[model samples]
Target: MGHLRQIFLFLVSIFIISTSYSQIEISGQVFDDQDEKLIGATVMVSKDSVSSILAYGISDANGKFKIAVNNESDVLFLKVSYIGFGTFKKTIQNKAQTLEVKLSPSSESLKEVIVKSEILRQRGDTLSFSIAAFKGKNDRVIADVLKKIPGIHIRPNGQILYKNEPIQKYYIEGLDLLEGRYNLANNNLSVEAVSKVEILENHQLVRVLDSLEFSDRASINIRLKKDITLSATATAGIGAAPLLWQTKVTPMIFTKKQQAIVTYQSNNTGTDVSGEISNFTIKYAGVNFDIDKKDWLSIQKVLVPPFSPERWLDNNVHLGSVNILQRI
Candidate 1:
């Protein structure tokens, strides 16, 4: 029994040695038709186009590749391919050899491509306006450019309107950073940093009620330039009469992961920057009244002027606001 087992093992070893010697190693150099070495070219050996790959190699920086195929097929197919070049294929015998393959550029010609830009386009319920088309050379802030866009309007008090109606929501890159107080962003954001403005008509503020409830109100979204992630605006002035001074500093950041805006404005010139912080979305949400004792209850208090507060009030005012929103 031991002699029989030794004979079987010896036969297995001979079969493995013969299989190792039968493998055919092929080395090749790939080059373009101009005789330039083509690096990262693919060299594959197979029995036929539909057959499984017998061996594969990728040309190195020197355009040299080595592939060993252990197939016993009498005829083998060698294929070499590279980007923008015609594939080279040839049938060869299963033998050890060297190859010098040259590939030619594809003969096909691509059609001419024409890129046309639109000032405004409407898709479904959304309207997109290109800022470059509407923005004037004199436009400093985004609000000035927004005013130039047809069908959109800006009120004297910094309220944005669409077709004589107010927008339900305001978003900077799809984020509600300032929530209802979007005037701070609309009046302060630079025009150069904005790329496009999109309006969502019949916008449903609540996602859950999108299909259930239909709204006629619209929403405005601002898309910033790709390179503009951080922006700031600072203005300071001193006048001669009454030692008048006004200064404002606003810094903002808008990115995919987060959005933040901080502003500090003080003026004795009656610029009324505090109006930017007032929530203008009161119409959408239920309103609550705040009764002041001096104004509401006291009857003998100094009679309030009918004109705007900025015109009657002659005092220094300072306003500070910070808004931030982060994605979890």
Candidate 2:
């Protein structure tokens, strides 16, 4: 009786081991009717035609997929599906095999997709704001619309502040063409030419040391519309108090290999248009001699009135500047 019991136990153990290793593997490549490999297709195995999923796999970039399902019965159901493609189903035998599935285009039409633009988006350390969502009808220049964006402030001196702190740098299409004198671009650039504004937080200027160094400074970048490579802004005004006049013309060109900005502004209305060309110093930064000292001294001598500059001060000023950046 003892010998018979040992044999029974041995046979039971063998049966259990064989059942444990009874998983059937199915490997296949999913393709369209045109023989094009369809990536991201869903391949699933089920015990019945409409039962719960037993195993599943997604086609890789090469449109290859592999699924392993337990051999519960002699047959299993396999299903493959992709967007805009008809579903493929088959009664596959519970055995390891490879297959190539070709899915035909679906006869049913999909609903119309209405695409909407995004107002704001954040990816990694960069934040992008769309101009169309923030720009108002009265906004003419890029600076006017920038004020409507949250967490951004434009000072009277044309300095851009992000979150109450001054930005470290300003860029146009990833190029620091204006250097620190970005007020010219900010005030003169047309709102229609710009598509979006991006802020790069924790910006590191040096690309070589990006991994080794970390920075807390933030930078602003202006992106132009695809069709707008050349833009110009001109303003002319004449008032009849004491023959006050102001005129400005700025033409700018941005291309894949070159960028240029030329400006000519003249005014007798005490607007101080020359300030646009002066360097905007950031925190913990200074200039050699403060090139804007003469302009500041003139304002001090006049004892600037509490009212607007166009009302009181009588003066004549002309400013012409040309800035160009060529990529090698």
Candidate 3:
């Protein structure tokens, strides 16, 4: 009986030693196609036939990662993923104790994935529109393209509305080139030059109070194509019967450190050109301004036309504006 008990203890000890020796450690470095170290790459290990994750880690700043597995007999599946790179996958048997992974650039694959996805993508507080998916042959300018976008509308008077409300600000490449007037850029800028349009929802213009203050206002931003550096547009029309004429010339320049837009418009056709250079009231801001203050007491004594003021007034309007923005 004593010998039998001793033999049982010896078998138990050997089983424990074998189990400890079966565990394995995996270590590896991740690199890009150019042999550059890829930091923050995700590394995942799972059973070859199972979908459950066994171990996972992210590559350090040096692109190095390590993970340990208690059951080496189980076939492991490794997956690594990073932005702008194709996913790397491999099946690990007993021989793969260490790994060196090289991820290839996947521009075409990434674009395909994006195309297969939805036309609109909301990340954080920004909503992005894919230009190719929303553009049409009838779209001559940015305004025309915006009219087709979901939750966005362009009025006949050149006002832009998002989610049935007007936006507070309009920007180009992170710069407010139009200040309070965005009609010139939206109506005259070429749609071919634009690559994407982003709406910053719940935006706080002030950076310091962004976290502390909450705002319901949104802003529109235009992103130009990479190859387009400068663009100009000009339109002129004349009518014979009513003797009406209109002309508009807009030139724009965009760069890394600066942006500029110069506009000139003249018309006798009753189109309000001042809307291109002035700021309009945003209803979300709860701001009100009484620009037309007419005293009824004095006007009552004079003979006024019963028609609307706009119909009774007749004048030629001319406007010229230059907006330059510099970024340090």
List the lowest-lDDT window of 10 residues for candidate 1.
110-119
Best-to-worst ranking by TM-score: 2, 1, 3
Model 2, range 1-328, lDDT digits (tens) per residue?
A: 9999999999999999888669778999999999999987777787878564566677888999998777568888987877677779899888889999999987755531101113455567887777885777798889998876756888777777886777778899999889778888988888999999998988888888778989777889999997338888898999886697889999999987788999999999778786688686533343222232234334335455798876776789989999999989
Positional deviation of residue 39's Cα in model 2 after best superposition, in angstroms: 22
Q: What is candidate 3's lDDT per residue for 1-328, written digit by digit as tens? A: 9999999999999999888777667889999999999987777777763454455567888999887766555578887877677778898874337799999877666667455233455567887776775687788888878876656777655667887777777889878877556877887788888888998999898889899999888888988886336877898999974697889999988887888889999987666676566554433364532222223255355676786545654658888888888888
Rank by lDDT, highest first.
2, 1, 3
TM-score per candidate, chains pooled:
0.58, 0.59, 0.56
Per-model CA lDDT versus the true structure: 0.79, 0.79, 0.75
Q: Write the per-residue lDDT of candidate 1 for residues 169-251, one digit (tens) a residue.
A: 89998888886688889888999898889989999878898999998888899989874488888999999766988899999
Off by over 4 Å in 1: 1-116, 283-312
Candidate with the greatest TM-score versus the true structure: 2
TM-score of 1: 0.58
- Cα deviation of 298 in candidate 1 (Å)? 11
